[model samples]
Target: MGQRVAYYRRRRGYSQAVLSGLVGRSEEWLSQIERGARDIDRLSTILEVAKALRIVPQRLLPGPFHTTPRQTQQSGTIGTAPDVVPDIETAMLRYDGIAGLVGITDPGPVNLGHLERQVELSFVCSQTEQWSRMAPLVPGMIADSYHASRQAVTDAEKRRAKTLEALVYRVTSGMLDRLGEPRLPWVAAERSMAAAEMTEDPLLIAGGAWRLAVVLRHSGRLTESTDVPTAAADALRRDDRNATPEHLSVYGSLMLKGAVGAASVNDHSAVRDYLSEVERTAERLGSDRNDFWFAFGPTNVSIHRVWLALELGDPSQAIDLADAVPLDQLPPELAERRVSHLITVAWAYYLRRRYREALDALTEARMAAPEQLIFTGRVHTMLSGMLRRERRSIKHDLRELSEFVGVAG
Candidate 1:
């Protein structure tokens, strides 16, 4: 509110260039941040800055988080809990503008919150009576979520950021595999500008950038994503501060980027090496029990590795890693990861014509997240398609299928 943030940074004897490098931003970006041209994204960044300048969040928060949420609590559902946004789904339906997310100002980075809304709305829109209407907005919605996240800088804001980030990853890397489109991760990369400027913590800033790299890789921008992680890693090395779980999670994400890239290029050599690197990253960050953010440990990265193997058509490798997953231990926030992955495994079996096995996996997945995060429409949307593909593909047993998808045979 009062240029107090800049005041503190300056009093600490750090110039824009000095802090920007530490946070993986350019001095120019920092200049803009001080001038209010940019938005802050990561809470860790905010916290870091507070410490660096011997201040706390209250100093820069012109107005701190709302004493109450913008919206009142809608009753949650039984399985996945609350289901009140029946119309929130419609707002997504109504948001038909396809101009695409411009991301934040200055560099126009991809916005994490924008992408997340994309995933949620897309999944919902995938069920649209005219699915096409919902299609174009997916990318832009994702972009806007990232924009919202770019300026996010508190536990409250991080909740919003990670929620959006997770949704985008689920839809693109997890659920919506049929639509072959390149996801733009410009938001994730640029959004970290806020993360860095607000926090003054290299690890925090790099973590935001690392998320962008993984998103980029997931979106098929392998080369750019491949090259990005090192920026963050380099920053982390330079900062040489004590490792926080959030920081390690950022590093873990970079390792995932390598794994995703190697798999995308079909380079098993690179893939294995990156997989090892991810494990090492997770191990190194093992002591970080910070709960919600960046809690994606070795198992989390391992899950991605299996997906990468699946993408590479190595089911044996997939099964091997799948066997070792401890789905129960993950944070509640990662419930969707388990949800979508279960669907993938079952669908994989179905693709292989292993009907019974496929049905079994479907049952397990249904048990994992029964309420359909938002669009139960898709599960049923495809059942008819599956039956049409082979009326008898599931010739013998339909009970599991019916129960799993909640459809009557």
Candidate 2:
């Protein structure tokens, strides 16, 4: 730990005095820490040091620490190897594993009840940004759900099982996107769409479509991305009269995804249309709800407004809209949204050339969800861009941020 701190500090060109000043510690104390004479056993202190360094807490710790009891229990069986940072090929292998599992499994009786619980667990993992913990479990869950769907005795049972299967793939797509794997998310999206279609559930189909659009948008297939959610939103609009919260949530989420896709391609008109649609849906929903794990509601709508503003080159407007977001209304369990909010704040600050403020925002984002921020490409890119443009104006913390995110300064 001391070695790591010293290495990162030196890598960022920070003197001991400068690093200690940022962390609110004396140079001698920092020296002791760096010299392996002081222990950093407290999680809070470690987190504080990491935050000051603009790095994730995990980066300061020894490898493969257990974050949950379940993870600890599974550790022995899962092997003691440290968590490897996932790359595009790692993401691809996950998809391949899923496909291989599906192909090799015979259509046999499956415990749908157990599989349903696993699905719920997987969703929790996704929501909480437990990427390393979740990656190993998804392929098996998908295979189990697929087998259950295949062997179901009735249509309702089949639909339920297949819906779970589709959701697993949807979660995989989301996880891959969060992990900075550009193209592999598309593979998961395609699998999700196929599984959703097999379920014959309109809501499931919409969910899958939005996931596809999200991956496409991230991969720069802006036109196809916009087309996907637009068509899904059109089909879903036909049932607007009797829409449930889940229905509205999925619909609104799709619209938001479409808005992003449009903004990506500078389709201002389409962007406005999509944002307007989501705003209206937000009004109907009235407040935040994580229906279908979409986290759709007025608060989320406001956040997207900020996101869209940032996308459209209006950082001031984005910051203003962000100020209107009811942070208290955002559920604590929605770590992904919170991390995203902070990331957007960081982007807005960066756009304004407020480098210190931007670094602070990103630091807060890493503190909020270190696992998510560490794996996010956008966060690293933002840090890199800021360092590239403002090298002379850079502070020690920003230099540390650049090193933390692997950006050459």
- Largest TM-score belongs to which candidate? 2
TM-score of 1: 0.50
Top lDDT prediction, candidate number: 2
Tens-digit per-residue lDDT, 104-158, candidate 2:
6474677778877877877877776766667777656755765666677788887
Candidate 2 structure, TM-score to reference? 0.73
Candidate 1 minimal-lDDT segment of 10 residues: 63-72
State the C-alpha lDDT per candidate. 0.52, 0.73
Worst 10 residues of 2 by lDDT: 73-82
Candidate 2 local Cα displacement, residue 261, angstroms: 1.7
Cα deviation of 303 in candidate 1 (Å)?
Answer: 1.9
Give the residue spans of candidate 1 off by over 4 A: 1-189, 192-198, 238-241, 287-292, 331-333, 370-385, 391-409
